[model samples]
Target: MQSWLDVDPTSDFSIYNLPFGVFETRDRAPRAGIAIGDYIVDLAVLAERRLLPLPDHAPHREEDLQRALNRPTLNDFIALSKSVTGAVRLCVQQLLMASSRDAHPPEVWAHALVRQRDARMLMPLRVPNYTDFYSSLHHATNVGAMFRDPKTPLLPNWRHLPVAYHGRASSIVVSGAPIRRPRGQIKRDDDPTPTFGPTLALDFELEMAFVIGKASPLGRPITTSEAEQYIFGLLLFNDWSARDIQKWEYQPLGPFLGKNFASTISPWIVTLEALDPFRVPMPSQEPPPLPYLRASGNQSFDIHLAVDLIAPSGLTLTVCRSNFRHMYWTMSQQLAHHTVNGCNVEVGDLMASGTLSGPTPESYGSMLELTWNGRNPLRLPDGSTRTFLEDGDAVALRGWAERDGMRVGFGEARAQILPALDGEA
Candidate 1:
């Protein structure tokens, strides 16, 4: 996909990927836009200018598309049928294509293009609900062996289903927001009683989350085959953890304050159309899934994921390198299990593939597993080491799907750890 835009050959936002996001100009309200290169093409502006290369038999109305694009979130646009989304994306692609650029008027580029750096990125959608799934077999097993019995690392139901817990959607934030060290109940290994204070074992989990595009009726379950249509696209996710607080609180009920404090996500939501070329066959399930969970075709994406740890002085270390395709359970299986009980999914709902650690120790997703709960520390580039995140430590998560010289990337989800509030009850 050649484009008139001057995009770097290695850039994540290649012409092939017109990933969507919400951005605000200095004086204007937030609007939906697509990443083309170093610039963002405002969909609303394009629609307002009547520049969309819409076909005569387009299924959706131009006015509706304009209204949806003018909104602060992409929910309405994504909620449209796949055909509509595909048509819009195709129109954008054609307009930007270098060969076709000569055919369009100059005003097409003038009104729609905005410098990427000048735009203030906002949350692409209002996430109605969030769920983090323990879908990575290696990540689950590695953590289980460290905390539970090494021999019986996986839980009984892990092999049969995608183990997951409802997450706090309200606390989720877009990338670049500062993360305060959360204060929660922590019981020292040597101490009998638990105390409330700032967590010392703060960590980052590298992950990828998908946004829901289509909504299902309340009591109707979306089958595995039907799940893909409901999915919008993927983004980088960081599930920050309070390991000390979690250790004491997780068994009885599951993650609460330890995880609810913050979860970071990249702004750009790469559409599924951009990722179709990177899809790969999912790993075989030894104990075959139930009828509803079984999926037939290529369901996993070969997205390369990595994490960088930066110290206060700017020393950086690429601590963990992993791949999304390494996960044993596919996204389809996760979504199937999520709605198998008649629970409906809504547009803009976020579902994360929890901690995508690969088959090697070097691919461990979180500090808890990478440092083995502080027994082994990771040495940084400047001789500093990390057991878990410390005050002023910054963590960045990056992901991209690349094949045959084309790339579709989620820029980055980054946050710096700040000191806890002075006083907390």
Candidate 2:
């Protein structure tokens, strides 16, 4: 996996790494690109040049990648097996390596390829469905302690299963998109009546999302061992919530509009193969999971994740710091539980590891837990107190895995809050 290019061995773009994404230039439509150094290797141009050794039976064409990116679905591209992805990566690496005798000159590829700074990156895949799981034991326990007694920090079934709820895919946007303040019904604990208006308690949940690359038949279940083959990559996810709205509506069923507003994800999808170096042992369970959810080997990655809050005045504070290893249930276990009932999962479906909090107060993932459900306010650098997000405030999430001499990053996911709309009673 040697490259003649002067790519830093410490960089994310080693010859062994090929992460996928979608980008649009000022003139072109959204299309697939592979990260190589500071530039983006445009897949459409490479396919047109016949540089990639794609199988004859493969359904993808140069045009398909471009069109699929513009549409709302990434199923066609994700369905490609690992063999095809490997071939594409090898070809791109050879084309970029200067020492390869058969390689084309840099000038030839430069005209079609674009610098990452000049391109507008979009969500790598069009997700048809999304499910968020409460997989972090520390997050669940900390939150439970605030609302319930400390002795009953965890629900009885928390250890036995991966608790999850369906999420809205249409509201999921790529990083940098503005999150509009959602209007909802809010009831005060001491007030006699409820009021309808913009949400006052907005918060962000730091998590990771796994994209499904392969589909299962409608009536078939994917086993734990087979789940890895179906996974494509990982991205940083911010599951924004309206806490005040949620407190009023969450009763018999789970969240509704409170959780449906907007969720932001990082543009780049760091492939699972790229993260092999960071694999670590999962935490031991209090009560073991059922047979269907059990998995062997190191099931989680040691990804260092953090969240930063920036006010409109440019003051930034590092609020939460944690690792992906805190998750109680692994991605394989979540996938196994998802299909235990024979519910089919399609390509491009997203599974989010909800709120990755750790064991300490400094590592809490959301404002709800950090502020103790608004009982205490988070003091800011400007001497202001915040129970929830305010207009013009921005939230950013960053994650990476560093091992040996290489560092693989998921880039960053960021969003700024807009003032609530006017009129409309």
Count the clashes in each prediction.
0, 0
TM-score of every prediction relative to native: 0.98, 0.93
Clash pairs of candidate 1? none
Where does model 1 exceed 4 Å of error?
53-59
Off by over 4 Å in 2: 1-16, 55-73
Q: State each model's CA lDDT, in order.
A: 0.89, 0.84
Q: How many residue pairs of model 1 clash at the backbone? A: 0
Leading candidate by lDDT: 1
Candidate 1 lDDT score at position 257: 84
Q: Candidate 1: global Cα-lDDT?
A: 0.89
| Model number with the top TM-score | 1
